[model samples]
Target: MKQNYIYIILFISFIFVTLYIYSSEIKEPLEDYDETKNPKLVFNGHWSGLFCNINRLVNFLVLYPNTREIDFNVLASKTHHKPFIGENIEIFSKLFQKYKEDIPIDTTYNYDGLDFTKFDLTHRKAYEYYNENRYKLEPYNKAFNKYLHLLPHLQERLDKMVNEMRSDCQQVIGVFVRSNALADEQPTGIMPTREEYLEAISKLDTFSKKTKYFLRIDNEEDYEFYKSKLSPIYETNIKRAKSNKGDAPHASGEYLSLEDLENTYLEIALLSHCDILVHCVSNMASAALYMNMNLVSICVSKPAAQ
Candidate 1:
């Protein structure tokens, strides 16, 4: 009888242990939990540009579906220099609607070093991952559209800017020319040159008087060059880093005014509204594509060796 009791106890203990392990496996592990029952993610910019940071945010949302809120204060405080002054969270709120609740500027939490291998979709490996997953990108795109809504005020501003550009124009050809300091920052031949851009634009039916160009060039010289070549060009009058001595202006370890930041946002926002985009591989271009994947684009690559 005692032997029978011991066997029964052992069987119950095994059952309990199995149940505990299964429940733990099913539950999403989080470092810290809030009252909302979801983990708050802290976005670390790593001194990246605005659109790159935005892309990282979207990628995080897609990969970690359980994240309901994100704090950017940590990024603001930790960077070598404040990229943009003023309320960071408020600026983000003006651009994107609240995903679930108001994204508080919680400084209590820090970036938990989450693996963001999937953040950079521009990488070659990401394309392979997409193909291996049966080429189904609907989920990722859906997450992007769901979380990336421009507030009505910003939307109104964007619409006004685009409408003015579209006025007296039948079509807008968006061009993103990555030049100036980027050539020094990136590996050789990674960034397309002025000749390459012009060659690609030459293939387009841009001779029409009704087609206007919206140039998103980084430097004044290239901007002027493209404007001269591609007549009737429109662009945001934002600050440009004409030097090749260091990083781009926004990421040059200098503090930028809130207005500068807003202009940068508007520039990318405007690029998405274009009927056709002609450009290279860049985060700004990538963000624009994410905004409007259906946009007809002509992506230029470096010339192959002879």
Candidate 2:
């Protein structure tokens, strides 16, 4: 009886190992597309989720070539909106069903099994448009609205700065201070003095006397002059962003290049990771409001350029 029991145990162990090996060989489906096999579909809706959402949809089309249907209509003006919602999903579904002869995707994508919240357009005219076209616009709008709610919950949603970069042995805090570049350059206004900057920093010192702070600035030379007075633990390259190439309207007469704009985005992401933000009346301050941080945020509202 003992020998028979040992044989049965060994057989069960061998079966389990074989199944594990077989499962390991089964690769996960990658998210990718071959534009040729599945033709490209123009994405018409609000472009916010255009790049990311379309990219994923294309991958689905490629994976299930026979079942996935392409709809260029969603990319049309009739469908796309500044804030996408629900009706768009139904339209997309109908288009897909036309080609596949069956519904391959769920009419609604339940987020973590929870029903998504409806979109609330702050702009009255836009809200009216959505209501009038509810059958055509609801789904896409709902998806985007759901995304807005989920954004604040991400762990690394606010880009990491000093806190995220700190080594296991060292600890630091990253700080972002901003003002409208155009505001100071206007003929009527003047840049604040080093004394003013120091005074503001001193006020914030009550939060942490020992926290190391890294200063980020758009104008490298301007910040250099204040470095000694401000006593920042570290400072990022101002013109370092100039190495990359692209352009955005700049108040300083010259436009910011692609590299410059991208660097600014990265810098903000890191700054938002900080425990606190000391802002002046600048767009960067507006960005901090969007980022949900755990620390107390003390923002100094700067007057708009007169």
Most accurate candidate by TM-score: 1
lDDT tens readout by residue for model 1, 1-306: 999999999999999999877554323233223445455666555445566567666666665565666665324421533367643433454356665555553423334223343344543222222212313444556667776677677778888998988888888899887754444322234667678788877877766647989998777777777888887878678888674333567666656776776688889889978888877666666667667655565766443344
| Model 2 lDDT tens row, 83-132 | 22233332232222223233344221111101111222211212122212
lDDT of 1: 0.63
RMSD per candidate (Å) reads 8.5, 22.5
Worst 10 residues of 2 by lDDT: 108-117
**Best by the lDDT measure:** 1
Stretches of model 2 off by over 4 angstroms after superposition: 1-180, 184-193, 206-209, 238-259, 301-306
The local distance difference test score of model 2 is: 0.37
Q: Which clashing pairs does model 1 show? A: none
Give the CA lDDT, 0 to 100, for residue 284 in model 2.
45
